[model samples]
Target: MSNESNLQVTFSKHCNGLFKKASELCTLCGAYIALIVFSPSEKIVISQVPPQNSGPMQFIEANRSAKLRELNAMLTQINDALDIGKKRENELSDLRKKNETQFWWACPIEGMDRVQLQLLKKALLDLKKRIGQHANMVVSQGTPTQTFPFFVGNGSSSNMPIEH
Candidate 1:
């Protein structure tokens, strides 16, 4: 307002300050930014971007391409598909737990060698015998008694039969 004749000088000072701030931001925070200003006199007063950043024109062209839009759509679809898969996996896990509770023998057996299978079989048989003995005692006494779960000295809790 005070020095209208110094239009060029004013523009130069403002541009220098803006660029300095932009550079500081880029260096301190590792952020790349672009600042563009247009004056009323149809003059492009300032355009600043970090050295590593693309020009405004290049940024616009890359963002506006059809291939970029297509890739974004594909990535969104893949993320949605993965979410659905996770939900389905949770549902199947619940179903498996329910089925195992109903029929312990039909539980999914994976990554088990022959020795492990034999040990599990022995543990299940011991559990069955214990259940039968506890039931007989309950009938004779007409009251349930506390029975500890069958342990096979293995470090696994699920080594015991799936209790109904």
Candidate 2:
């Protein structure tokens, strides 16, 4: 008897066959491999194999399981952050409604009992219209007017243009 072995493995043109070959090599040689690929649309493809001999399979399995746990932990963290953001958004919307109803700018003049809230609202609308007209007049006249940069709410601008 001779301790000799001859093994032949063939693969189709598909990537799954390649994966099987890699897995076979890992199982026979007691090695580990981490593979990553990508499609044209920038999606990720990944694979991993653990050592097969010297009790390393358990270690590899553990490591792979650990990685899965890590991914789960990260997903949980992301979910928590999203939940917090949603809660904050709801709170902000509620605050806006409250603020709109209790607008100090629309309050009546001090010590004027006869002034009503509706009247104050009409006055503010008139003032806003006048301001808008003045701004349009200035812009139409091509006056060198200074305008301040302002944001209506807390929104972030990203430099990278995401495709989807």
Candidate 3:
């Protein structure tokens, strides 16, 4: 099979026949196929399918069932991608939340406006100065410095480019 805008009747018919056989097999014995077709003109086409509920292995029935299986696989992949993206987004959000709890003045500044990022940086700088004084006080009193939280916000304060 080939890609490169397969608008030819013979090519389409062959592709349909291949898919039909694949469908018959899948319906009869729970088998599936992952088909990859490359064209001589520098293009590639990938087709995949999943098991489906089909009637007797006839052309019309098989074609309908095979089409449905293909569509199902396509939709399944889309859904999976969305779910994973959302899950990772949620995980990163949770991590940022936890980091903020530990370092109230420090958090990821992505998706934030310049004003917000600047606010965060200023807040962190002030917190660092305050803690430095607190550290000095603790040292003078000969107490453990471990009790004070460490504020380690990496990168330059010029995180976001300011616009004129």
Candidate 4:
């Protein structure tokens, strides 16, 4: 036979022997094994001994599914938070509209009992006191005061300058 043919036979025998030894090692030790061979003619061989019922592809798919489940759970939580935020925003908007439509002082006082009327009077008194205090503060700050001339209600053309 030709020298090239002999070399090819030798190479094939060595590759087989290597694979056999690897298989025996895995069987005896119950260890995982991966082997790769590249031939001079650009041929390739690959072998893997994975666990009994699982392979690399199965593990990857399982991990991918687990991640998907985790992401889905997070998405659900975010959506729920958004829903709650929207509900709170709607409630605030309604409250603002109610406040805009009717001020506290503008509400009907006809239905107020004596206690409610007293509370209202107290609130008004407090408000008046605060207003007076604010006015005094403004005056103390040396803000320029303006005066306006007005005619007295009595049938007389008199210009009375009221300083404010």
Best by lDDT: 1
TM per candidate:
0.33, 0.35, 0.32, 0.36
The C-alpha stretches of model 3 lying farther than 4 A from their native spots are 1-57, 108-164
Give the clashing pairs for model 1.
Answer: none
lDDT of candidate model 4 versus the reference = 0.66
lDDT of 3 by residue, 49-153 (tens): 666655454555778789999999999999999999999999999998887655434555565557657767775686678778987888899986555443333
lDDT of 1 by residue, 5-109 (tens): 587678778778888888867655546687877753567755556644446545645666867889999999999999999999999999988876554445556
Better of 1 and 2 by TM-score: 2
Regions more than 4 Å wrong, model 2: 1-23, 26-54, 104-164
Whole-model lDDT values for every prediction: 0.69, 0.59, 0.67, 0.66
lDDT pick, better of 1 and 3: 1
Query: How many angstroms is residue 115 displaced in model 3 relative to the true structure, after the best TM-score fit?
Result: 18
Report the Cα lDDT for residue 44, model 4: 89
Clashes of each: 0, 0, 0, 0
lDDT of 2: 0.59
User: Which whole-number lDDT from 0 to 100 does residue 1 have in model 3?
Assistant: 36
